[model samples]
Target: MNREKLMKMAGAVRTGGKGSMRRKKKAVHKTTTTDDKRLQSTLKRIGVNAIPAIEEVNIFKDDIVIQFLNPKVQASIAANTWVVSGSPQTKKLQDLLPGIINQLGPDNLDNLRRLAEQFQKQAPGEVATQEDDDEVPELVAGETFEAAANEAPSS
Candidate 1:
């Protein structure tokens, strides 16, 4: 009888069913794009002037660690470091992601937009306009624009 039980236990382990065993798996995520109009309409339903940063597209990652400039977020994470893992649906992990996000405060979207505008302004040459396109003659040569500009006189 003891031998029979031992054989059954060995069989179970070989067949991949053992007590308290967890199968190793990698995390998977889905991504999607939404039109701004649809997004703002959804936010309107929630009575908030703006949507939360973490909810926006391209947010959240597993391999990357992000820091926030906001004091509230900086203080919260200062004490909490252990990650909640195992599964995305696991209540512990699910709860932790949002808490981390909130503590970090709003995503740096505003700062990002400001920086983008700054870069656009600093970009070389005058901003392209439809009027400018009309003012400039169509390309007559196969040479690149820079080559053509070099051949032409400076204003």
Candidate 2:
């Protein structure tokens, strides 16, 4: 009877091991929508009004670098959050922004331009545009906003 019980326990353990190994690995889809509600609300509070289609909010050991569709807008939010009187320790927070902005390569630039266009259409008064400026940047013939954004990634 003792030998039969030991054999049954071993078989059960083996069966469970096989089941655990069969579990599927989930795909990691990076987007801002998955961020915590408080973080999202804070971003909205600072005038980063558009929903970022693509975002990389990496929390390093010492700093949290949030890369979103619009680096400029994200920078503005950081400024507003950090520069206010009686605000919390912002020096470290401020340190992360420049590096984060520097990483806005070609793919991110295009994303920002697309986000800017959407914001322009949704909130005309709030979003800035080259067309709205007194002095617009010159573009060669057959050039476009998308093309300019797609030209080269920033360092």
Best by TM-score: 2
Tens digits of per-residue lDDT for model 2, 18-62:
445433457998886656667657766676543333333433343
Q: For all the candidates, what are their Cα RMSDs to the real structure? A: 21.0, 19.6
Q: Model 2 reaches what TM-score against the true structure?
A: 0.20
- The number of the candidate with the highest lDDT is 2
Clashes of each: 1, 0
Q: For candidate 1, write residues 32-111 as lDDT tens digits.
A: 45565675565445444321333222224542433332211111243333222121221333345555545443556555
TM-score for candidate 1, residues paired by index: 0.16
What lDDT score is found at residue 7 in candidate 2? 72
In order, what lDDT does every prediction score? Answer: 0.46, 0.54
Candidate 2 has which clashing residue pairs, if any?
none
lDDT of 1: 0.46
